[model samples]
Target: MSTNTENTNAATKRVSPTGLDLDKLTDWLAAEHPGMVAGELSATLITGGKSNLTYELTDGTNAWIVRRPPLGTIMATAHDMRREYTMADALRGTDVPVAKMYAYCGDKDVLGADFYIMERIDGVPYRYADELRALGEERTRGLSTELVGTLAKLHSVDPAQVGLGDFGRPEGFLGRQVKRWKQQLDTSKTRELPGVEELHAKLLATVPAKSAAGIVHGDFRLDNVLMGPDDLPAAVIDWEMATLGDPLLDLALMLTYQRRAKIVAGYETTDPANYDVTLAPGYLSTEEIMALYEAESGRKLEGFGFHLGLACFKLAGISEGVRYRHINRQTVGEGFEDSGSTVPLLIELGLESLKEHK
Candidate 1:
């Protein structure tokens, strides 16, 4: 997990990992994308992904990526392959860098769940602070600035112009988000978190008025962006949570992660899902990130504290879900063993953010 992730291209004679069938996948690709299979396919489950199951597929000649839901029970509304594929497909010609979507397979018979194929872009997702620090202060600063700029550019895009006007209902997005996360937490609840109810109540009471409607990369963080050799974001992957919503929510989440990144770096902790590269020596500060986003997008942030609180609440809900899966033996990859410990801290952070902002 974290910066330790790398796609190993070494050819191996092995069976497909859990939740994927290489032979069936080859058949589907040959039918859907004719002549793309080339030879017998091999797939390795890509690590560092905490939510969706990502696999790097190769047919001895070409390499592609397949994204699907994790094996075992998943939330009905979560892990939408079509939604992820649609967002990336729509953003092809936009300033937001996304991988090239080749095809989408919605039939459950093909992969036991909806899935999509996209051309693998050779880019590095720097997940740890040290990995970014290794790039030296100047390069790290530039990459971090580009990361913020890419998000601002994403917020500047008009969803209607990109054929994603109806991607999500922005009219009551904030309210629905609070309620949705509460419901999500309910479904994944395993233990009584002390501050969960208080955080939920605070978020529900402090819903911010919508500012601007645009694409919200629901999970906007350094690890989610793939950096090319030139220190620019080559592609923004993991759009399973992307949708039309208040763009400021994305900013708040990014800020919250940066704060957490600083804490992680300070404590020298190893929470893969929460690591952020912004804590590197020369990365942008939270204040600079907000100012740069406001300047680049021309959208002044209002009621940002509420957005930050909501972001923490949403993250708490998500972490609780991950904790639930880990306890039930349903999670994939490493670093999930510590998920249960973050929920209460996230809830506490949400409450504190609300109080401080208020």
Candidate 2:
């Protein structure tokens, strides 16, 4: 059976699709593009991509990436191709790095699921802490700075420039986030867990007092930032989570200070090869990342405390959702050995964040 993916961001979900039993991918390619004689499709099973099935494809000489919803019952409506396409299209002339889209296939008849193909961007994803450390001090510093800078550029982009104004519900965004995730977690309840409710209440009481809504990389973490030859960020992938909202919350999601404290997943490093991402000693501090926004975007850095708290809350809910999958026997791959302790650690992290921001 195919693996199930955990939901880590609001609105964007990782799910394995159902009845995708088509080896006809080659036939479709051949007929659609005429001269392009597509042969046997090679699916390089890329793991750690909990929600999407990413296949690195090659049509004889040319390479492309195929992405489809994971196999299973997904909660939301049809996949948001409009949103994903928007980010890739918008990044065309911007400083932010994104894959150049080749074509988007919405006809589920072709592949038993809707999928898209984009020119494969080359770079390695890190799976080990040591690998991040091994990038050496110099490369790691550059990697960290560039990663932060890429996010800064993403937030600074003019939504009007890319015709993406119809993306999200901007007003009262922070106010609704707490309740939104709380309801999701509640509905997916497989266990009677405590402190989850309390965490939501604490977060709702302190939504960010101010926000600079922009093109937010909803899941801007080290893993999402693509690293080039010398550990420099090539492009940020996984735009299913991208939205227009408070950019600082996006920053905090990347840090994931809370999720680290509380454990989830079979192992922290799914792939040991390139998972080592070192946060440089002088990389943008929480305060500095926010300050840079103030100077560049003209959005005051007020209620930063609230944003930090919300980030922690979001991570906790995400981890808990993954934990729920494990309990229900719906998760793929392996289960964590230290789950008993992991859940508590996450709750504590959420509570600690609340106190810090308060």
lDDT of 1 by residue, 179-202 (tens): 989998999989988978878887
lDDT of the structure predicted as candidate 2: 0.62
Candidate 1 wrongly placed segments (more than 4 Å):
1-14, 264-275, 356-358
TM-score of each: 0.92, 0.80
Worst 10 residues of 1 by lDDT: 1-10
Give Cα-based local distance difference scores for all models.
Answer: 0.83, 0.62
lDDT of candidate 2 over 256-321, digit per residue (tens) = 542452243326555444222433333445555556656655666445556666776666555555
